[model samples]
Target: MDVSSTLVFAGIILVLLWLFSVNNSSKHRLPPGPRALPLIGNLPQIDSNAPFKSITKFSETYGPVVTLYVGRQRTVALFGYDVVKEALVDQGDDFTGREQLPFMLKATRGYGLGISNGERWRQLRRFTLTTLRDFGMGRKGMEEWIQEESQHLEAHIRSLKGQPFEPTFLLGCTVSNVICCLVFGERFNYEDKQFLRLLNIFTEFIRFNTSTMGQLYAIFPWFIERLPGHHHTVFAQMDEVREFIKKKIQEHKETLEPNSPRDYIDCFLIRMNQEKDNPSTEFIYDNLVSTVMNLFFAGTETTSTTMRYALSALIKYPEIQEKMRQEIDTVIGQNRCPNMEDRKSLPFTDAVIHEVQRFLDIVPFSVPRYTLKDISFRGYTIPKGTTILPMLHSVLREEKQWASPWSFKPEHFLDQNGNFKKNPAFLPFSAGKRNCVGESLARMELFLFLVSLLQHFTFSCSEGPDSINLVPEYSGFANMPRMHDIIATPR
Candidate 1:
């Protein structure tokens, strides 16, 4: 058939598909939402730049649980604290299926832990958690790793000689090194050219994923893949990352010692051999490569971005910075590097760090979850294959949850007695069984790196506190803080 004939034929099929969807949706009692167009459903109603904010506005009309669409994909978004909690936490298993995002599917070639479900997800996640724990993920050995990295970070800053510099890459290197030690079994020098290139790829991947082009690719993969755009560069860089991981795996294979697993890669290699006899096993080379990609990318960007944003928070609030410094000095003192043991004694500093994560609600929309089978939630029957978004931004900023939900107040994580208190609503790593696998590691890095920085330096900017905006530079995939050139004067 010619192009025009194919176009006409495709149009007829789309009309039929949309009609079938509308009819089935009613029969399934899908949640109520705004009216949608045939092919492009609710995409027109959303702000392409920041879809979550636009979706939040939809909650104003449709109440808490509502159905919407991006193109032909039917999506149910759970808003507010109670409803989100009901689905993600209270009814966790039913909603545990991870959506294979088009971009991620392309990056991982539909392999790996980050986007896998069913037996694959269970096997990888279980093995990953167990191996990470064995390697001191949240324990004293991990604390020592961070404490040593803390000194390296401090030295890098001191070399700046109080001159103004953007903390994005430096913080990226610091946080990336901690994860590197866990995964690769060694840390790269701060000045290494190749190490910096890898971190830069992580940042670019994040930036592209949040860009308009990224959303376009996710919603219309077939068309976007054919056309020339920024998405192409992203995939290329991702391939470069994959190649790097593959090379590292080869080297680890040469130096393999099953009795003494050096890091995550070594442990995974050992597991791969143990499961080599089983046909149903998920511990294979493809998984090792992709899972490492997942760990490296997720491990590097999220924590490092949080660290960079943490500094932006301090730069914006010098008083808060000084207060944290005082707490660090009083508790841990300036003579030694800050450790996890010092957290309880440094309540105010701890509160400030928690507040920073909350105020800058990174990953505003948790990674999308899908319904693997027909499921009923909140008296509504949602059919299988529907997408679910438990909007973390809504939960974090829910009016009923915090006294000043929109403000950057450290007291949100503090008590009347001035001790650090935990808030169930503070979910930067998200919640439930499918929550961040690197939560403990990220926490340790945040505490040690921030405390160490606060201990040695009093951060400020020439533009003054009034100039620093707590709002993110980008608002989609992640809430990235605005980068600023600030001076870190040694205390």
Candidate 2:
């Protein structure tokens, strides 16, 4: 009953109460995941060398919804179609916000469609959809642009004359030009220095994104931003892209007539002026620059990489390539370029392209989403501000979704009667409101470009039959195939 004894007893009680509360809160908030060490959290559990593959393996052991604490934040990962669909489709708006990664936020300033969320996201996304539609995306005009670009790509490849050359540049050029046509109202010639420089910046940004320094920056941006490293180089590259977009915007503003919009930049400028006085307008110059940056960044690498894989896959499976060529010849012939409408009649070719996307599954884990409010799923509570990562690759390769998820079978997309069948689980572009804005354009480009090239030539491995490697090269952000030469001989 002495004063010192009373103080000691009170301290013990306080410690016990704090420990009890911590234990209970951790149990309810956290999902099933591997144990983490102090400070690093589950960083060591992640294989930085091959993050996607590592994450996929981790999901297998931890079930579909696995939580990992990285730095100060906890990320809830949803694997398989059922889980991803339920969160993205069944409960769309609840998980529409994006996790604010330090590096991305610094670079984008929480602008643009990719990383920005909430009201800004709504307005930008709606405007983008409207502008894209007005510009003829998913329509005949856009199809014509794709067909033209596909022919240009085919001609460039044909000029290579089956030599041992890298197709990366050609593919990037062709793919970027599609966006160029949309945004700038003109496509650049292959040798244009400005276009080449822009592509170089894009490549560097992608390369930097997959670097360890980039990962470090995301985890500890406060420390990394002050230090000198590849993060600076990455930021510089992003700035270069932004500058290019800004220059184009300036040009459009000076030349574009308000009464008639010529391209994406013009449309954006007009909207920016229209919303200048509005307090909640996200249509400012900075957002416009970043939006265009996102378009080129997302639009180019993904479609180009898929096309590269398409050719590589064709070389690996020559019989399938030959069959596709035969189908193209029978359906569209070689006199004219392949068009989007041709997709209906060319079921085999369509199936092959679909299989390419499914097999490759670009953007494996989609750009992360953050919960704006408390949400419950499968008896677990996902608290507000919790990060949700929809494992798109897992969904694409889910056993319940596809009969041969691991194999490259075009028949998975074909019916018994040999017609192209739509699979609900085919979500390479993702699902819900935040799905890829370029989905329609990307589809048209892939279908038209693949069919056009196949119509003109046959792709065969330059290496001996035994030396082909189907495993993709762990490139920057996207999963690119290993550098392999292919002979594109005239059919």
Candidate 3:
């Protein structure tokens, strides 16, 4: 253990790390990128606060399809509308693989539809979509559930009587209840402590997962796991959510009616029974628990977060809020409940909602895709096991696709006639084979809930519209809006 001996050991370690980087980098016809350092790779070049911006910057030098390393993980980021669409839409079969992010893998214990691949994914996705459709995910039954929840939401806000309140958990309760109706066949009262506690856990879990520490955990999980931080607590809280889902599943099993399924759980349980004889069937206890967790997690947060951000955007631009209200008043009137059928008639309102999603740019990195096998895309050989990121931020804000990509302009989604126009780049739900399974459900919830709120009340905060910041509080994993207190005055 002399000084020279220690120096020899350190030299050997650096050499091994250098060899590792060379093997990953120089082995294939990988897309061009900045020269990565050993072990840490291109992480030093990335901005922790806005990693998407850093990745987009790489495209400036490396072109639209660029390869870079995140710690030891090799990532291929697709930028701009053309590159992303070409990879995710044109050659979808190759780009359809979902990256089983370490945080999510640990959360779901590698069993849910969110991170599963191949047979498990195909079976669960198909069955889940079919069951949801049968139970009216995008249909009249689902719309009714959202409308009912909107009534509860309005009543809760009215109880405040224009007193300023933070809408974070309130919006969470409203949106989560809609999913509860679909998945658990019941919705809890807003005052239910257990339900409220679970919602709080979800908020923290997402915050941690999108934090710099969370990104670090994903990059160097082996090292980070050995150390200590909030990651452990996040996983433990996720277990609590899973336990809640398990309890609901057990209740559904007790009340099991083979002939008639009451909700998503009932439908899944019935399927489990039908597929019991098959050895390879994906319907089982683990898949059931994890898949329900997936539905609950995905269904609850994104739509609710979008609505929360929408309110902030409205407060930031009161003119937009007033315009939406004027349109809603004209199309549906104040007395009638908003429905999906009314979306077409309320074009300006629809455009505003669409603009909110585009402006918020949640899930900017979309869920990372993986290469199941070596493949040629855009003349680059993307090696097997490479993580692919079709940056939705790039598509949503690409200059070629959006006239004013950086601005909060509802006119982006409107024609000269002011009719709601469709833009190919408006991909808040993402696109391609692995796009969000809950897209239809989310769209229904956003349209109905927002319209219902505007129909009943006008949203504003105490600090005035000038003080409101439409920019997100956090921009990694998902763009999390900053929480604020706002008044909801009855119209």
Candidate 4:
């Protein structure tokens, strides 16, 4: 053979050998998953249309811990309670980090508690827990706040005067007001223009984050950052929320009486000053803004959406609604607003709320986490820095955990004696170190507001031949019910 021909032949052999070695190496390290084409990974498999349901399908085929590639990065998706619990709790410290998406990094500058991990996460999380406790989250003082807000919510609903109205705005007002009381030390009137704008921004941001575009941004942040899309709108809304929080912080700073901390912002400003000289302190204006935003983001939407579903379920099943109404009337009289303390005495009400959370599963797949170090789970080695998407929806619907996993049966939360029974699978607030910090507050709000509303009004579907659709329409980051009107008749 000629010299040129021999050279080309040797090059071809070397290239083939390298490709073979690379493919074999990937087979050993990567978890079993459906085949994917180059560059796209399993993006085609994802019904960008309904990613949550699509991921659930993948779980069924690939087992609880399925690995998928988004662009060049591979992520481990843990479905079901056993796998999710094992990764999030058993190896908690090893998987506590968060993936830094471009928009979030730009918005938070790597300061917020929700996405920040390691030392920053430790300090901020500890301080937040302590502050919330001091503010009476699980105590009587916070319960009083919830009770007051519940009354406000009930009064607003009563103003509907048996008209067929959508409960979205009222529920949003009630949930947002609870956070407002916590952060700003007061509640906003239902008609407050500024508060309404903030709520609108929040709703938009949530919708954007749960869209296919949001997933694309997370995967290809560099490319998405420069492009104009809903992702940009999300970033803009984030800035608006942050600026509003900053203005509130400034107002608090100017009116500061150091000895007396009035609200979350007041307490945070005091901490920032106290830790001003500490180089490692995560307490600052940026962190404060992000923390307040986090509270608003986490607290408002999830609770309100759950309440919306709860009421919709009640409207669909008038029998359950009447039963719940009777339970409320019998347990707590209608003379005054229902209190958090009344939850224990009202088992059916509590069970109904719990069932709503479980069945709706607002956050189908929670905010994703990253493995901080090499960890082994169920005979699979999850490498450090690998993203973990825990399918919380699977846990909420796990057959092993509940008898009727797919139904809206309140009996799942009620024992044979007709008392509220705590199920280990009821992990709507999630579990482990990253378990919801505002869980107690959320519970108090849901219980007090739901029971209070029921006390004042009995929700029913408006006069229509079509029945209320219980199926949820996927939106942003929550599984929200389709827009429907309810007739809130006075009980």
How many pairs collide in each candidate, listed in order? 0, 0, 0, 1
Model 2 regions lying over 4 Å from their true place:
1-29, 475-477
Best by TM-score: 1
TM-score of every model versus the real structure: 0.98, 0.92, 0.97, 0.92
lDDT tens readout by residue for model 3, 28-125:
89999998877788999999898998989999898999998898788899998888889988999998899989988988899979999999999999
In candidate 3, which residue ranges exceed 4 Å CA deviation?
Answer: 1-18
lDDT (0 to 1) per candidate: 0.89, 0.81, 0.90, 0.80
Cα lDDT of model 2 by residue, 425-463, tens digit:
899888998899999999988888888888888777656
Prediction 1 global C-alpha lDDT: 0.89
* Residue-wise C-alpha lDDT for candidate 4, range 207-271, written one tens digit per residue: 66667777677677887888887777778777888888888888998999999998888988898
Q: Once all C-alphas are superposed, what RMSD does model 4 give against the true structure? A: 4.9
How many pairs in model 2 have backbone atoms within 3 A of each other, for residues 3 or more apart or on separate chains, i.e. clashes?
A: 0
Better of 1 and 2 by TM-score: 1
Better of 1 and 2 by lDDT: 1
> How much is the lDDT of residue 177 in candidate 3?
91
Best first by lDDT, ranked:
3, 1, 2, 4
Superposition error at 312 for model 1 (Å): 1.0
Q: What is the lDDT of candidate 4?
A: 0.80
